[model samples]
Target chain A: MAALKDIIARDYGTPAVVIDLDIVTHNIARLQAACEARGLENRPHIKTHKSPELAAMQREAGAAGITCQKLGEAEIMADAGFDDILISYNLIGEEKIARLAALIPRARIIVAADNPVAVDAYAEAAKRAGKPLEVIIECDTGRKRAGVESVADAIALAERIKASPQLRFAGFMLYNPEDAVAQTQAFLDEALAGIRGLGLEASIISTGGTPNLSNLGRIRGTTEHRAGTYIFNDRMMLACGAAELADCALHVYTTVVSRAGPERGILDAGSKTLTSDIGGLDGHGLIREFPQARIARFAEEHGFLDLSASSRKPAIGDVVRVIPNHVCVVVNMVDRLIAVRGDEVVGEIPVAARGRIV
Target chain B: MAALKDIIARDYGTPAVVIDLDIVTHNIARLQAACEARGLENRPHIKTHKSPELAAMQREAGAAGITCQKLGEAEIMADAGFDDILISYNLIGEEKIARLAALIPRARIIVAADNPVAVDAYAEAAKRAGKPLEVIIECDTGRKRAGVESVADAIALAERIKASPQLRFAGFMLYNPEDAVAQTQAFLDEALAGIRGLGLEASIISTGGTPNLSNLGRIRGTTEHRAGTYIFNDRMMLACGAAELADCALHVYTTVVSRAGPERGILDAGSKTLTSDIGGLDGHGLIREFPQARIARFAEEHGFLDLSASSRKPAIGDVVRVIPNHVCVVVNMVDRLIAVRGDEVVGEIPVAARGRIV
Candidate 1:
């Protein structure tokens, strides 16, 4: 193994995603420790890295299985020998239902559904497979994306799952904004009371999101914490004060391809690599060496770096590391991530679930 | 071949990029005719489709050559039997220069450079390969992207390319906004005059951009027009009045995974598939079936569909078609695109040049 810089200089190409396994291991340990100290099970979401290798590290570090946002990702992880998978999305359509039923014999799959249309499909799939499927009711706290609106709807969905002979009502799950944590907690607590009133014991009250990682055990009824982006903290995490820049393990190594003028420079990496997911951030990403230079905009293959704010300028051919605004999207863009341990190139980790967006 | 509806019902998965070959062939012929009528060479930029098959279709439709935005794409096209390639980007860094030099023998490689740094790299790569590489001067032309600022700088860079024994100075290229066409034409005219004064022929004055496609031969002295998105018009194209909704050839077929409420629904495809590229549009994309429904926002695997505006709403298991705000980024996200003819499933076209960001 050579130094990371040496390996980058000798082997890696420009505009590549490089991951530091040393920091990854540390980040995993940190999150595991946080969950353990708070009496909560840590279910590391695989959407962040989309790598079975990284998910294995999290599981070995004492994670309670893994979480996937889609059935496609879950199928990939199950193929990679990851059991007890939780797909935090409604499995709709006959195709997905049939696929989910087929996946039952391979691993324990827990699904989330906010409506009966999804619940009926899950029931159909479960009955088709002749096996009981675990399901959780998704309650809308404040995310405004997908979830049942009221506690009554949550209880009704729970009853519907309970009524299905092939389905087991696990509990509730909610993904809310950081500001709506208190509201979400109250709704979950009330929903729990309603479910408990039906003589049903809620096994898992799952709450997730990387931004909500810090408030894991603080949410009273949350039995498990699911987080994804903490494995490789990005600029968004840094902006939210959740992680320091040193904790960012994944960085895009891009070369300055064009210094159009003194005020403007262009990097080889752009929306295709770094992504246009600003997420209300100031810029696309953070340049490690040139901290003051703002990534103003991006074309498909060109990242416009505003060099006017910085006294230090990068020359053409100079490779700079960038921590993307959202690391998950960046990981989804590439086929494989360059794995590095400290200052050495470890290996290439295939993003087996990179484009599994079924 | 089975009908597309039948194929999708029996085989295809949700959240897929579907390309109508009928429309693609029509688009190619239409653009080629437009260019030919204007006495301009149509050099189709492969960045939109990122498929060698589609690029070959352009070639068969009478395109002079193919235009790639990166050396990696050029290499892919060359490997796929494309003999003529114009990589409309600066080849920077030792590795890229070496790759470019090696590719010169495989195809007719034309490189674009805005500064001495890129010109010098092209010269070095050419000298190493012991073959003359064609080089073009990229003018800024009010796009504020990569290009020389003034006529003097353009002339200086052209002279530098001409001075290199291994480099051939081959006129100019500009990608300007639709509003900046007149300004860009003025600048290019002056630069062409200056180059002619230096006893240079300036044979290839290439101007490109899908938005500027209507001004194909209107710009005086421009010999070639490079348009990408016309082959698969997107929502942005529709909004910009470049193409009608019917002209959109590429669309994402996504299933409604959750009808969270009466006004809100969620699609399986999100930023990962459709992308978060708003590009000054009202929403992320245009829903073909539900024209009034807006794709409000996106999570990683969930597209938040605001259906308040539409009388008809999508239910769980219902799949809808979406024309993305930017088609190029969507094509880059997937490994393969489903090809169809009218209502029939033709085949799958592998996006061979996709993710070739370097």
Candidate 2:
């Protein structure tokens, strides 16, 4: 593989998301192998890449299926002939339900619902479509974002889904707990037993996050793992000890547009490209070569690069690659990714599911 | 105009950017009136509202021209029949220069540059196009983002632009200084005198920001103002006392997807919709009806609403409006704006210049 600078010089304009296909293939295989070793299904989340081509690669790489966060993304993937999908979000409102109804017959999609309102809506959409929509109860194992609060609540929701004619109670879903893994495991264990006692099969125990990839086998009942950021591991993943810097595949290729002050260099990418998602990292992104240079601030289009600590300052028009704080948001901001193989410009992969926020 | 709730009920799905066109028109006229009363040319920055239609409306309301932060945005506006454009940021690299060369023949474009490197590139592009491109020297008048550090540097840059046969030296450009207006005025006053002493006509003295709109006519030798956020006043503008809550024209219409606990509610919109730009505000956005509910945190597709303080809690599937922290970024996140006039949805306007980072 040629140096990144060579690839950048030969192929890119400024502020492009450059993806190394070699690294991407390696990342997919690594995660897949890890999941397979743990006797777990690798249902790679499509939120990070938002590319049908990339999702296709994951499906081809001994993965169980794909996971999407939104109905719009799932629709795009379904359009591209993805059969099995898990929309890991509450499908709310009448408009979404109508869309879900239309989508039910096209492919196998399992949606996770935490509240009874969402479960009822999914059931309505399923009834309308005349096809049973598989649903998993989102248990609040530890992540207090969205889920059933207790084991009893999880069982109640599972029973509710089982009562509905157009719904199938799949199992339980939880975003992999970071530090409270044991507590979360206990909650899931009790919930699973409770669910099984209700004469329902808890086939899919989906628990995942890129940061908790190391605990794949350690988790008691995690039948499938859903990880998004592992495809293009970023500074956040590196900080969490999930992946190394070399493992990151996606990089924001930007040009130093200004050196207004002796120590301050401004790049063409800012919140619009790199995003303001710091993800508890030091700076907006990590400058690959100029490691000491901090991306101090951002205008809509200008990235303020603080080169005070760095010995290597990027001169005006000098192209540099930045590994962003959160790769998922970075990918969401762009329409396409500049695909590269070493120094060669391989192709352009359209982010077909980009800005599918609904 | 009809109530916002009626509009949401009739016309919106969750996670939509609903623009009140009447309010947008009123906001445009208000800014234009303020600029006109002060004898300043109103060149509304298109970075906030990337729609060519809104740009057209601004032009109709007596704006001198449109200001764009990127070359890609300028191209989009030019394609939509905008002939006079002021690209506020420095256009860097060979690819940008080549595009600028192509753009010169089609439009009356004025570009700002703070350094010799950028000035040289503009001259090269002008030379390639066989046209004299009007260039302005950006002076660091306290806003310290991108500009020449001193009056002497500004004069030197102006001279460099003047020396090039293909370039015409237009005046100076400065982002409106907030509290340091007196010092910035002194710098600009000296720079203006210095440029005039060199037998160069400083025709355009551009200084602007929505926050500094109150200081419009107070600043000496200011010919034009560039403000973007006023078109769709956000919580940032409201916090700065630049706008009233009623003055806010654009809002994110979202649905309450979950009520995990009695005090906790989660909306379908998150960082992807509302964005992570807090702009030093309290929360991610202001819930219109439930002012006490804080947008505490965000997952990729879920907005955690802290409803502990709010008396009015949104029920599941209930659509609500959100005024984002920074409106400019919120506009950039979506593809189209749901244009409304009270209860009636006028049309869907495509954000033609969205994600034009380069």
Candidate 3:
């Protein structure tokens, strides 16, 4: 089989997600080393790559386990022989609960929940399945997206889990904080204090974000770090000083299909491939070959690149690699990642959990 | 099999794309009737639904053919027994050309190109396959995304196609214009004048956009209107006054997974499900039940719904139907669409060409 680099030069198609395996290996090693140096358990989130094969690479690099955002993703990872998994989303519905329960017997399944309804449902499902599920109380440190608003709510949920025979109070999980060390330490200190007051010991404390991965030691109470995007850094990571441009492992190989104007051109990849994730950036993504060119706009199947800033413009049929704004969402958009090592197609890693949105 | 409406009310999973077959049938009939009344052919673009079953429904509704944005999509449509297929994209590379060549024998494959390089490649591929490929000169009407800038350039490409033995000059293709009728008429008139001046005939003049579908008749010299989103009108269409909310056929069923605050809750659907296609709207999507609510932001798998404006807020696990800003990109995000009709799941339609980006 032609290496991915050769495939791109030869028979490879445009608008395809190509992963640099060498970079991925280096990324995994670097992040793992950082966590190890901090004495933090590195549970890399598989939601970034969504590939069990890549997860195995993380595991080989000394990751304690893996993290997933959904039960469907956890199921995919579990089926691929990953025994320890943490589903970081509050899973609801009987179908999802039943699926979660099914995974408890096969893997060391840990789930996060903030509300009583989800906690009750998870307890019931675990009881019905005759398996004790490890439950994590998700606390909202600053990011108002999900999790309990206060440490009291986190303690309350942890107490409820401690009181349940089917659910075990494992730890607390929080995401995306400006000051991870200070915010997470405060949240964990209060929650842990409350848990200790209730005669309970918290087994784990997790805080994760690629932007804060290197500063895990400063997060006083965090025992495990669950950073996902660090494994395949993107423009967002680069912007946040989490990773350099060279640390980005994935790139969408696209062909310039039409030069609409001297300063404008269209690529085969668009919203469907590169995605609409601005990631707090100005444009859609960065064109590696034409750094000055801006991916100004995207239709579903066409990426409009503004080449006016470039001294030399590319002609039609020229292939350009784009580093997406958010690599995780971009990874989930495609079916498989074409793994390449120095212009050689090393392997084809199927995105095992690409659209497992349940 | 139960109807989709019943499925949504009962066993359907949240964050799944549900298409009401009744609305789809009605939307298809309504648009087809409008095109028929104007004596224009309606070739609905399959890029929105990406399902053969839906395309068959379109064919049953008297569609002239189907429109695909990618050759991979055209190949899928061709395999499903659709003969007249127009791939409105610049076909490039030996791999893509070979695939396009393979589809030529199976379907009446018509492709668009704005540059001579693409036209020459298509002609060469057609010659190698011993099949005459229908070539369309794409003109940039107003959407500065793709297509030749001027009528002279369009005629020049048309002339090249007319002179080629392997390539057939079929028509002119353009996409999304602010003033579709006036702009398309002017472009078509000039291109037609230029083609006639060169002693040639412009067989087909195709223009399409859901926003301008109603004004197809006013665009003189165009034989077919290729509106895709009319079959599943979205918030963009609703805003454009092209179609009412009643005409919308697709809805994403999502569950409230977290109630972060009194006026804020997170839905299970986010960028991965609903997509980041704001369609020039303020938010990500429109929640049908909570029209006053704003889909403020999106994480990869979580949609933050602002319930501050809504009189009533939903609790966790409550399913709400969200009509995406752009349905085409949302359709591409999922693996399957739950087909429902009047509260019953009629069937599960696989998104056959979901990730056929090549």
Note the residue pairs that clash in candidate 2: none
Over A1-358, each residue of candidate 3 has an lDDT whose tens digit, in order, gives 2245337845668888888888999999998888888888999988899999999999998999999998889888988999999889888877777677777899898889989888987898798789899889888877898999988788778878888999988888877476645766777788888998988887878888888765676767778899899888999998889889889888888999999788999999999998898877999888887899999999999999888789989899888888899999898888888888877877789998999987
Ten contiguous residues with the weakest lDDT in model 1 chain A = A1-10
**Tens digits of lDDT, candidate 1, A1-358:** 2245545744767888999999999999999999989888999999999988999999999998899998889999999999899989988777888899899888998999999999998999999889999998888887888899889999999899989999999998878788887888789888988988887888998888888886777778778989999999999999998899889999999888778688899998889889899888998999988999999999988899899999999998788889999999999998899988877788999998988888
In terms of lDDT, the poorest run of 10 residues in model 1 chain B is: B1-10
Per-model TM-score, in order, reads 0.97, 0.98, 0.97
The alpha-carbon deviation from the true structure for residue A236 of candidate 2, after best TM-score superposition, in angstroms, is 0.2
DockQ of each: 0.69, 0.66, 0.73
Docking class of 3: medium
| Among all candidates shown, the one with the greatest TM-score | 2
**Fnat of all models, as shown:** 0.67, 0.62, 0.76
Q: What is the per-residue lDDT of model 1 for residues B94-114, given as tens digits with 9 covering 90 to 100? A: 777778879988878899998
lDDT of 1 at B31: 96
Candidate models: Cα lDDT each: 0.88, 0.88, 0.86
Better of 1 and 2 by DockQ: 1
